[model samples]
Target: MEYGNPDFVKYAEAYGAFGHRVESAEGLAPLLEHGIKTPGVHVIDCPVDYSENDRILNQAFLRAFGSRRQAMQKVLFKPATGHGPDA
Candidate 1:
């Protein structure tokens, strides 16, 4: 579950393509513009901090579908081994 982040820029260059890494927020727009304007398979490695994913995504989901969460759980927990209509 914990696959470490690889150097995507180097990986792209290994394949003989253009690669760029966004070092700061301000650099993103310019790098994106350059990549789009002139490109032959460009890869931009923009590191993102997802530390608040659980708080942001889970809480929003719970708020939106709180009443239907239990109902949805039944379908989600159902076995998937069946192979036919009668199985």
Candidate 2:
């Protein structure tokens, strides 16, 4: 029920104000309301599960969006070097 990043709330809201898409897990639904479809973000109702360690990383999360937006719906995770941060 509590977000790890307190700043995310204010930051997300600010982005919403600027017409930037906003989405979150089901729990965050309480935070983003009143403007479900008014040029705003889409709050996904999926929980983050690191259980997919063999698949996702922090950067994977960032890349997925751009990939989806730029015609590459498939978010390839290259944890080797060609992708994500130097983790």
Candidate 3:
């Protein structure tokens, strides 16, 4: 299911915190630096495109391991007892 994209900057500001909106990739570094150096709760609303997440992560996993299935097998933990929620 999809959710509404709320104005995170305004939300942060409403809670009496520092809010910064990154307009471009160049602005991200400066905003990050400012947020870290400054005091109080700081929120940086950096828009990210997650469309290529699966492809990128899968490629990285393939490079690290031999294949995506191998990576999943290594990372995913399976309970031997089978006494958990799913059981």
Candidate 4:
């Protein structure tokens, strides 16, 4: 595992780029607001934890669908009773 800034902020500095480091969700709003308020190109360094990716994605999907989990499941996966495309 290489140890360094994954967002490569140093490179941005070398190129005179505008950026903000977002260490947590709390920093996101300010960064977003800054991007919206400012006119120049901006970079937001927001690293995410991929370990809980499944749970995070599932929760997001559930929230978006709003209690249509079963319907989403049917659309995402076919029946295993050998009555679909595989059959």
Best-matching candidate per lDDT? 3
lDDT of 4 at 17: 76
TM-score of each: 0.60, 0.21, 0.52, 0.49
lDDT of 2: 0.48
lDDT of 4 by residue, 1-87 (tens): 878556655556667777677899987998899889988767777777787988887787777766556648765775568677778
What 10-residue stretch in candidate 2 is worst by lDDT? 70-79
Q: Write the per-residue lDDT of candidate 2 for residues 1-87, one digit (tens) a residue.
A: 765534444565666642223355554555456446445564333335567784565447556555444423344443355666654
lDDT leaderboard ranking = 3, 1, 4, 2
- The list of candidate 2 runs beyond 4 A from truth reads 1-7, 15-36, 40-47, 52-87
lDDT of 3 by residue, 1-87 (tens): 978678999999999998789989999898888888888999888888888998998889999989878888877854366677877
Best by TM-score: 1
Compose the digit string of candidate 1's lDDT tens values, residues 1-87.
888799999999999989899988999999989988995989999999889996787677667667457536745776677787978
lDDT of 4: 0.74
| TM-score, cand. 3 | 0.52
> Residue 16, candidate 1: how far off, in angstroms?
1.1
Compared to the true structure, candidate 1 yields what TM-score? 0.60
Could you give the candidate ranking by TM-score, starting with the highest?
A: 1, 3, 4, 2
lDDT on C-alpha atoms for all candidate structures: 0.84, 0.48, 0.87, 0.74
Candidate 4 off by > 4 Å: 1-5, 54-87
Model 1 segments more than 4 A misplaced: 65-87
Candidate 4: pairs in clash: none
